[model samples]
Target: MSATLKWMWVLAVALATGCGKGATPLPTRLVPTRMPTIAPSPTSTEPGSADSGWVVAARGIEVRNLAVAGVVPDTAAPIYAVRLDPALVRLRVRYAPDTPQLLRTWVAAHHPLVAINGGFFTADNQATALIVADGEAHGASYAGFGGMLAASADGRVWIQALREEPYDPAVRLDQAIQSFPMLVYPGGVVAEISDNGQRARRTAVAMDRAGRLLIIVCPTSAFSLQALATWLASSDLEIDRALNFDGGSSSGLFVDVGDVRWQIDSFTTLPSVLLIEPRTS
Candidate 1:
């Protein structure tokens, strides 16, 4: 079989979901693949096995790596994240359903300070949940379920669980995307989630009490939704709220802040992505 076809096979197993209602149906327990070869940036202080305390990647940006506890089948998972202070940066949800590209490809096209995979999508690459790009809406919200991360015209960015707080149609949003099962709630509280017993690579979006946006990824197929939620709440990250993104082969992140640079390529191309750039006052 061709390499692309092989990755798709791996992708199917990697899209882990069992978040009750509206969760994408796919197998779980992702098989980690050899990351594409790339030389580390000169300023990149590689994260070792132990936690490399968040390092300043650039103005208003910090990067870190944490080793997650072993699950039933794996010893430890590799977690990487970048924290962005919204006051210094702005977020845009870019949708290109007709022309989805890999994370690296998107970076080459727009050169955002940071970018990561968005929410779920159908097999044909259409976004599964609501997506609003440049004030134009596509797809649909998750009803009284799931959660959304949005940026409004007033320059406000927030993460909300739909079950607790539904989307208000009246609000004008510049960027938004919905995904299943709220992870962390306000006050660093872990959202109650039913553990589905399946593990896969994971991606999530979160905001802290200070309102810094965080794009997180687990490069290994070693975590379940419940496990991830619990970890987020318990970790020192101080997450106020978070939402899960489409995972497995679909998970990826790219960053270019000063001398700090790294690209976590998704096993497959993505239909939508969250782009962050310097906030122009």
Candidate 2:
């Protein structure tokens, strides 16, 4: 059941149950490409101080590992986050539902600097929500539910909570991916999730107040949705909007950039992935 394509594809990932009302769309605009920014060499050569233990991995990328202990009652893990400046990093999506593979496989085949598991899918490798790669939409959108990490036609990238910002069909997207049960809202507010105390490995995509993208992963299933959202609200990340990607056995992340090297594989193979590459002028 191997699926091939002339170009990479993307679709949204839907939650298993209930939906929410649409709210306001996020407003993280992509900084334009003036002065040949993000290519060859960036304007600033001085790395930021290692405050908060963040390592500047590349010109516009940073990585950090946080030993979160007692952030929530009986919940903790060594949380990982890769921060990227969209002005210097390009986001792309790859789909191969019929040929599900490991995160390493996607990185090896595409040669991206970083990669992570995308949204949710069914047992048959079918997307449960919507994904728009290169203007081609596939799978059904969550509609008035969940949240989306999407780029408009002019290269503006945003993570919108559908409950606050419902999807507008008239808008053309260059790339987009959706996921269920948004965890954080604007101004660092955590969404209250109702679950029966089930926990799994967690992954999330967030936009910081500075408009930087944060790719977060909790490798251990040690925290529930409420706990994770609580930490995000209290953490120093200053997150403006955040959406939860697929969790449990589908969590994974890979990195191979300046001063950063990692390879965290998921418990199961993945049919879709989000890739990051250095933006060229």
Top candidate on lDDT is 1
Each prediction's Cα RMSD?
A: 6.4, 11.0
- Could you tell me every candidate's TM-score relative to the true structure? 0.85, 0.80
Which parts of model 2 have CA positions greater than 4 angstroms off?
Answer: 1-52, 71-76
Q: Candidate 1 at 4: error in angstroms? A: 32
Q: Give the per-residue lDDT digits (tens) of candidate 2, residues 1-281.
A: 23322111222112321111111121112111111112112212211212236777778888776657763344335577889988888888887787988777788899998888888776577666788876788886776668999976555788998988888878898788888778998778889877544555678999999999999977665567777888887889888888988766677777778645666776567878899887775
Per-residue lDDT tens digits for candidate 1, residues 101-141, read 88788889999988888877766677766899878899767
The TM-score of candidate 2 is 0.80
Q: Count clashing residue pairs in model 2.
A: 13
Model 1 score (lDDT): 0.75
Worst 10 residues of 2 by lDDT: 30-39
Clashes of each: 0, 13
